[model samples]
Target: MAVGGGLSCIKYLMFAFNFLFWLAGTGVLAVALWLRFDKRTEGLFQASDAPSTFLTGVYILIVAGALMMVVGFLGCCGAIKESPCLLGLFFIFLLIIFAAEVAAGIWGLSNKDKIVQDVKQFYTQTYNNYLQTKQPALKETLRLIQFGLQCCGTTGTIFDGAADTCPKKEGLDAFITTSCPAAIDEMFDSKMHIIGGVGIGIGVIMIFGMIFSMMLCCAVKKGRNII
Candidate 1:
């Protein structure tokens, strides 16, 4: 009876953990979509002349979210069914996710400065292209970013023959107080900490999931042996 109760407790705990994991995955998916579609960040995606580090990061988030949802579902099913095979599969998935998360976290941390610099350069080129081509979509995106961040050109100062968004002097309707590079750095820095914390938190949760899944698998095997 005691063993049965312990197993039941573990099963419920696993379910609870997996449910939260699933929710976290959903949140990640939402954030990734937002980043991909947000007007202010659209310039990062439209830059054809530069490497798309920001877009690549968004893609990674999307992939991670999808994997998390799958793993979470598998874990829930495995725990509910008390199936050794499913639990083993869940363990394998968790291992893969764990390794990937670790690698992503390390890469993000190491390339923090580079990512900011790349973004700054990308924004500058995009803005310049917008000036020459006057593409409505690019113009609108640049305007949104400049006004939203209260930032001007890449250096935060109006360039010679700058666009309407980066006027030489402050106007009644338009004025940029910050630079794009500073704004981008500030925005990404805050987001990076939040993302890093969430990643670490998820990684820790995955470890627990793995441990519990293995334990449950062993229990299921032991029961079969006794039978």
Candidate 2:
């Protein structure tokens, strides 16, 4: 397997790339888990009526991140072992993940408005329930939402202000503030380009990975045939 030539160089390069990719996948999985289960946010998701949009996205991250780690491990092992069979499997897994990512991007774009509306509804319900019950959990949830979005109540007016949770703005800014719903929509709109850029970058990386796997697999087979 060690054909000891340029193919060896490709093998090491593949191993290094996949090692870094594995680390990145681990980091992504960690962050997603934290967001989903942190003490402050866990209550929000555990409720019977939790919104599916946000929760669904987190679950997707968890699954994708885990898959990435597995694929990366397989890639690293395949490269080091120069096993054509392992490399073939790695290429298949990578292709599947890439396809899934592309599909997710398209689905997200097509349903952006629906996603925003679903989140807004959840926020509105939480805001109202807090006003009536004044429960600490609800209050903290609202605080997290307001602070995270850097937004205030629905109207941006005194009504539903829930000032304690909203970010502090003084003078003119207090009167003219962004509402949570608007902030949510604006966040999605503003980040569209960034999301797209990231997706394209990942796509290019996957394409290169697939190409490398196939190249290495072919070279390994050729070396075996020669020997």
List ranges where model 2 is wrong by over 4 Å. 23-48, 132-137, 159-161, 190-193
lDDT of 2 at 103: 94
* Residue range 1-227, candidate 1, lDDT tens digits: 11265877888888888888888888778778777777657556664554467778889999989889988998899888888889898889889988988998888888888888887877777788876888877676677677656678766556444557553454633443577878888888777777877787888888888888887778778777887
For model 1, the run of ten residues with the poorest summed lDDT: 167-176
Q: Candidate 1 — which pairs collide?
A: 156-179
Worst 10 residues of 2 by lDDT: 39-48
Candidate 1 local lDDT, residue 157: 55
Alpha carbon RMSD to native, model 2: 3.2
lDDT of 2 by residue, 53-165 (tens): 76797689788888888889989999998899999998998889899988988887888788778878888999899898998888888887777777888877645537788
Error (Å) of candidate 2 at residue 80 is: 1.4
TM-scores of the models, in the given order? 0.87, 0.82
Top of the candidates by lDDT = 2
